[model samples]
Target: MKYFLYWGCSLEASGVNYLRSLKPVCEALGMEFEEIPDWNCCGASVSYAGANDLAIKVLNARNLALAEKKANYDIIAPCSSCYIQMIKVNHEIQENESLRERVNSILAEDGLAYNGSIRVRHIQDVLFNDIGTEQIKRHVTKPLNGLKVAGYVGCQSVRPYGEYDSVHNPVVQDKLLEALDAKPVPFPKKIQCCGSGIFLPEMDLCLGLVRDILDDAVSHGAEIISTVCPMCAMNLEMYQDRINEKYGTDFDIPIVYLTQLMAVAFGMDLKRDAALHHNVIPPENILKAAIGN
Candidate 1:
């Protein structure tokens, strides 16, 4: 139940609410997270597009080295982008001696070295595989009462590394919601790309992707969409108005983190534990469904 937490750039900035909601949810579940000291960005997919392999690997390797020095716990990143970046580096270093040597040599400047002993995992993977639904059910004080929800499992979480779940279609979030008495609606675009990495550069394309996901969720009778990644949540929730303006459609969908939904079911404080106030599209309906207030 313990892991080295890596709070990437988003969690500290635009994704702050995700980190806020995560704290109490993990606390309620008896999960302990020791943050890796002085951890840098995992050099997201966007970074990979611009930077060289060595630069990205070095960034993640420094984090792995810090975690190794701190303790023997596995590293966990709540952000899907961070999870993929770090895991890719961890996977690569473990298999390629040349890559490891190069990364370690760069780290040597900072008096750090990564032996690739730690495992990098997404928080969703840990919650679904390690924590289990039974344990989660036991913590649910306020069942969702069949609240229709779409489990948006964005692209980065499962793709290219389907260790615990399917790459194209993941059900961990849906299964977890079911345990909380929430009815998971059939969302075809659950694993759809939100175009997060290229959102700024390709605004139109990203909006189309976001609009499609939201459209699918709304069409399937989802009252709200639960997400695992902050980037996805932000893209979906924050851009609804823009999407409506651009597409000549009226769409107001509430986007929430899966952990936030868990917090609601656990009967935790909406503002404190769930950080519902932070959501762009206020999930007032979700609040009413879960707590009947």
Candidate 2:
């Protein structure tokens, strides 16, 4: 199986290690991974706020063109924001020919067109649907038997109409966690927004929202939070200290990317893989306790 690896701005800037870890795992599972050549930013959140229609159609269409030219396979994005933007654009272009034409006119400058030839998918979708649970299970060298994990789907991965995965009650992350032998803790805020794009502009609101989510997860007995989005991981991990100071609560929950958990279950080196680079509490001690290391 061949896939076009689409790394959005955040992943390229800070989450490159995740792509590094995922590629090796995919290769081991008999999948050919290729990066989309000359991929640009997915316009981040500003594009949507400034020009919703043009932003979605143009930014996502450009990335799709690159994938079509290079790999011609489905594009797999590790970043939830990129997945959302690309999928949103593809849906809009296919559904509305007029909008598609308008966007294509912009792309014509670079000799690119959005023909809807490619499909955009999140990493979780690829892992759960394309890769399958049995294949994931085979890579487990040290199963996470007693580790309790909270699967954070975030808003982007599940929301927006006509998307690949269901918005409410998403199960892909949970399935992946279960397949790795880690217990998936159910919480009411599973699909809740982690104040994603608003983290910087609205610090108090973001921290409060995150605090509530973490409290809910902890209340449900989640020891570590697992997420597919780099922003979600950063928020959940990086904001714990501020939240603790504000609320006088001990929110020591560790945040980890789903890729990191998979690497650990497969007995891959955590330290060397930069798993410890997270700002939240480290998961090493908890994982070690689970395996009695």
Candidate 3:
């Protein structure tokens, strides 16, 4: 099925690896992604902190209005923060007619109005619900051969909206890993917060949280941590050395996107398609497990 991709800022910069692996995986799965034209930011958490609800809603409304103007297809957001923000606007506007009218009135400035014609879906939901595990299994050419991967769902995707999967106990990512022949380890803190953007101001606080996540994954015998959110991957992968230094521990775990693992299992080039070379923590163990070289 075709969907409009709402690529948040990170995909072009920090999360480029996710963008890289997403392309080949989608192609192999027969999923078409059309980027929304002239889409703006989804306002993410920064807007929430500023306490300007309408501003954030209007930001997402502009994108939704644009997508509706193009065609009536689901908007797929790969970023967890973007997905939550967009879906929040979609859900709230649908439930609150007055708010919808207000948002549309603001959109009138740009000759756009949203009748709530489409749905906002995360890439994780689309891969799990729309494209079932069995369907994904068909595309796997080189199975992971029991690679131990911890699926980090993070907070943005599950919190404030658990429509796709259980917020408390998420299984979508783990299920996808199992379909790829990778062993999804029993990780308790999968849903715990990764301290997201707070890592910048509160490095110590964020580092503590990241350290916990990494420790939990390692304790559970996970060789790699797979996630859907770029922020989560960034926090988990990019801070290993710092975490080790601060905590007086040795934590060396690879953080890879779920799409990357899918690309690898589908026999896509590790360096070219999966973009393993771009990851902060090299997933050499995963490469060895999947390719056996």
Quote each prediction's TM-score. 0.97, 0.93, 0.97
lDDT of 1 by residue, 10-84 (tens): 988888889998888987788898989988888888886788878888888899999998899988899999999
Candidate 2 lowest-lDDT run of ten: 271-280
Winner of 1 and 2 under TM-score: 1
The list of candidate 2 runs beyond 4 A from truth reads: 49-52, 162-164, 277-280
Q: For candidate 1, what is the lDDT?
A: 0.87
Q: What lDDT score goes with residue 66 in model 1?
A: 93
Each candidate: RMSD to true structure?
1.1, 1.8, 1.1
Write one digit per residue (lDDT tens) for candidate 2, span 1-293: 98888877777556655665676666666788788888887866656567766665677788887777765699887888888888877777888889878888999899988777788888888888888999999988889996899998888887775255677677878999998899999998988888887787888888988998999999999988888888888788887888999999898888878887887787877765535544347788887776557
Poorest stretch of ten by lDDT in candidate 1: 284-293
Which model scores highest in lDDT? 3
lDDT (tens digit, per residue) of candidate 3 on 1-293: 89898988999999999999998898778888888898888877766788687888899899998999999989889999999889988999889999999999999998999998889988888998989999999998889999989999989987778978999999988999999999999989999998986777788789999888888999999988999998999999888889889889999788999999998999889888999989877896656756575
Clashing pairs in 3: none
